[model samples]
Target chain A: MRPDTPKVLFGIAGQLIMQIMPEVRTPIAGQTLTLSAALLSMVAQEFDRAASRLVEENRSVRTLLAASRDTVSEQALRSRIDAETADMHEHDFHVSALQAVNDRLRSLLIDVHAAVETTPGEAAAGLNERIWDELKESTRRRHLASGLA
Target chain B: MEPELAKYLTSKIPGSTGMAISNVFRIPGGASRETWMFDAAWEENGESRSEAFILRKDPPASLLASQRELEYAFYRAFEDSGVPVPRMRWIENGSEALGAPFFIMERILGCDSNTTRIQDAEYAPVRDAIARRMYEIMAEIHDFDWKGTAIEEVLAPPAPGECWKRELDHWEQVINENELSPQPIARAAIRWLRANPPPPPDRVTVVHADYRVGNFLYTVKGIHGVVDWEMAHLGDPLEDLAWSFMEAWEWTRDGRKGGIIWAEDAIRIYEEASGTKVNREALHWWDVFGSVKGQAIWLTGARSFQDGKTAELMMPFTSYWLINFQDEIMLRAMGRGA
Candidate 1:
């Protein structure tokens, strides 16, 4: 823990890739070992930012969904969005919990986006654009800083 | 496994006795099939005969669930054609043959299919030539006549105007069936795809659905063989072109299409060779569709890994690395990357 978890993971990944992978007898086994190393490197990256990214993205989507309520014409969708927005506060900081909350909110965001797009109004158009923007931002939030890709 | 393969080969080859398989090894990168390479030696008419062969056996589950017979037909149809493909020898549908249905082909030797090596300085001299021939061979594939060939026996040609809908519908269903979590971005992309469909091609041709930089065997001299026909289908030819241009295949990650040529250059070469016009609108539509299809593939592998159907590390590795990256690709293709 002194060198941090990510550093330790990368260290193990480096050993697997540079040392163990070469010693593997079969080609497929070697390739698997190499991929295992690369996976570790990427997993380390995800471990570093998984929680923060999920929490940030959940908040972002909930904000967009709440704002989309007025822009959507579907009453049912608006009510669902309101309920989802109200439930955005992630009581559990675990990555899995945050991701569950994120999934719920993002699924609602999709419905809100679909509703807003079909509704012909300036407000609907603006909300649609915001949804696209949030979607793009979400991709950035989940980006992993690893050379494996 | 080796003994069974050798036993099967003994019956397939004429005048062969004492058939034995050696150096049997798995070849990585075949996500859908359990691909293996081995050397088979037998006594043929009082002489020793040894040859290298590649076997592709279907796995229990995979990134793509295409019929092996269809893939075999495509390979067989293209034998001795302008498109360089390894000669397909035998296709057995009986799962009892090798625990699953499989086909055998002559192994292409002394060529590298590694996507990472093409950009290395060792291949710098022939990179452009490889890129040119890559598209040129693709043109040959598009131009091949499949009317009475084995290809027609397996895959029915889609209506020219229906290629877009057919492919989009297929991949959307794959995503719907396989996705563990809600794919909001992919779902939105699918909606947009339906809203704006591309025009059909003049003729439906053999679309090498997974044709890309890494999928082919190449050397500093040129490409030796185009492999991976599991996803091959009869569709709009531009679909292959656009799929090749998917950002995921751009190993350089610098917007170079396939990491060998720019989009304009690749199009120019392909157009001149295939005698087909590159419709920008249709190509753009296919590019976005390609991302959706790519995401579907990664999702399928993810599900396969999660379901304990496979212990292949490549499954989860692909899911972790490409799933979100594919989302970003779709966003960029849809003009929302900024």
Candidate 2:
């Protein structure tokens, strides 16, 4: 099959579906087709960015973790951040590895979040604000056009 | 004999020849009972007559302590009291034919239960007023004295400070058993709840645990009735009030309390009609607790769907649709990292 054959076939099938189940006569069927189309659209988007988004986000979190070395007072956490900072970014980093890192960072982010919530001082406040901004921005990058960002 | 049901219905409804029941269908409303909506016919006096009614059968998953008979009694107590409740016709506890205890009642007449479309302009113009009326009626329910009704007889007497504990423990146990996801937010809220417990209830009253905009029937005139009394029990009345106003049911996203009426307006109407003041802090406490309870439900739905325990429409939809929203609610409620 040609590279674009799947797209052409999906479009043809979708048109047939809509013609047989117009919204006025069959709203549920029509809605189902529309949702299927949307799901396929998401599949296409994900196909293009599946790895890139993970790579970008993993790098961002690693960057933030390194940046935290100056702010975190706990020697253990600081040393972990320092080691993670020294780690080289690898192209061979698989999707699962990136996601695994993401999960660790996210869980650690919660700890960082809870710690900052209890702590005071401008450094803690500023660090907390930066973490919030990163979380917000990360959500923005992942926002679906169909949803509220 | 679905013998208990046949005997119970026959004795109460005086009839004659051809008074035989068949094709009994016990539908699932298992949290409350095995609800059977079926047909009955008989010769009353001399004429042949028929009617469609509901049967409530007690099951193992009694979410609360209230008996099926008490629900029937409450329904009977309020049949013609302008409460828009179903006409509860019969109650049968002896299990013989159906294999479980059950009751029969006149099924409510309305569209399928849904609040998702209540906000559409087709239903919206009357939606606000209907919501207001529903809140007012709920206040009337909150004020309905257990002392004067059969509710107190079936429900346990309230303790001085155990209402919150009872509710929290029940819902938390459900989550512990049924949760499909790691609920960091609910876990944190449970901790906060235990640490800063709400004060003892001003009054213990019957709580409809699943009260919300969706579990009701409304028309252009106003709310016709509040249905689905499956999770009814005794608790702090404010728990009912807060559950009704929980934020997850905010289908309209216009600050409409439970997608029905505005929070302030609903509370005002409730207070005016019930003659009972709602404490803002306690209600807020119940509101967060309501979110936790809702998470438990969504969690249960996911577990049931996965375990093939129920084939209901909502089981998968709860996990696919509302689990994330429940997390979002937990985030907002706890005022953590949002």
Candidate 3:
């Protein structure tokens, strides 16, 4: 154990109680505390995974954006998509870079989603399923620890 | 309120009364109104009187919420209609009276607000019957008309298919504007929602957008009242049923829908009471929609906490407690989570 471990635990209890006790001790406080501790623990997990999750999402989005160039009929969106695909830099990927790409990809997702809604076919269906696939993965990535039962 | 303000309110309660405001606590956001509970007493007309009264003030933030007067008027209009709501005695909208704004109502007595009670041993035996009764009340509410009534002018117009669209756009817009991190789950849910629009509702009815466990007041015998009408709106009534039946609210984390009844049984009970058929597919749509809506609200609360908009209980509580489960709800809606 670290030399300051006792102090750290003491600090945690002191800080949490000092900050949250007034509101925490209201209706169903125990439930609130248990849930809060679980969430804080999960946030710690998500903290470890955040950059990776964003990196993966950004990569997935880039792949979809590239694929969209073949089928998305809107010339402007297609040209933009191709340009984004051509500028791919997987080297030295950071959380901020992933976040930037994630934003662009999400914007593209909205367009792609709307586009597929208008045009109907097996191809569109496949793309829709791909979007859903990403969505499911994203949810899995974002899952947090919570009190059950 | 300041002690002076509390004393002033004590003065306005009709007769000369000296009462103490014991543990006058402020809960989290009322969203639609400022809700505070305090003890009040005085000579009512002539004789001695004492009782707990809750003050619901209309804050500057809640301007476009469900009309305060109208919300009160609904129950007042339906006083004999059997939907159990607190007797809303007075609604004061003008801010001049009490710094912000407020309403007063008789506080319903002796009820616990724990969200876990439905499955608790004390209440388990009666949960089924209470569940049925709650659904029955909701069905009756769905059957009631808000148009040919007193406060029709106050609520937003009930659009046909645009109801879902309007609500979705607003909530999605909120997520877009305030989200601290990427919200891919809500984003996916929105796409799915618009892509597969549910059948146009049978008719728009009063929707209690936040109908779930922990929001309602109940006894071991049955539900006495369903509280927290902050998100009440004019929309498909089935939205309430679906929101109530959402699996995340299964406090036991089992198949028990709201720790009250099974999903099928909930629908059956509501249908039996309202004489309306349950559209399974549409209800399924609303169930998914409920998760999205739930996430949006929880996210908003988290944003409030992060932004320091209000250090209120609910904001942090939701940010901590409900946000993760919201993702789980998303996974379930996407056919991923259990």
- Model 1 residue runs over 4 Å out of place are A1-4, A147-149
Clashes of each: 0, 0, 1
Q: Per-prediction DockQ, in order?
A: 0.64, 0.10, 0.30
Error of 3 at B100 (Å): 2.8
Write model 2 residue lDDT over B1-338, tens digit each, in one string: 44555565677775544556665654433343555666667887788887777776665443333456656666655666656777776665777646767777786655545667676778767776777788778877766666766666666766849999998998999888986544545665776788778888777766766778877766676776666776677788888888877667777677777776778888898888888888888887888898888888878777876777654433554454555566566656666435
Q: Which stretches of candidate 2 lie over 4 Å from their true place?
A: A1-149, B1-37, B55-82, B89-103, B110-113, B116-128, B148-150, B157-161, B191-199, B258-260, B334-338
Give the DockQ of candidate 2.
0.10
Docking quality class, candidate 3: acceptable
Predicted candidate 1 versus true structure: per-residue lDDT over A26-71, tens digit per residue: 9899888978888898889889889988878888887887787777
List clashing residue pairs in candidate 2: none
Q: Which stretches of candidate 3 lie over 4 Å from their true place?
A: A1-39, A90-98, A117-123, A147-149, B2-5, B27-34, B44-46, B57-70, B96-99, B156-166, B169-188, B316-324, B334-338
Ordering by TM-score: 1, 3, 2
Q: What is the model-wide C-alpha lDDT for candidate 2?
A: 0.67
**Alpha-carbon shift of residue A52 in model 3 (angstroms):** 2.8
Measured against the true structure, the TM-scores of the candidates, in listed sequence, are: 0.96, 0.69, 0.83
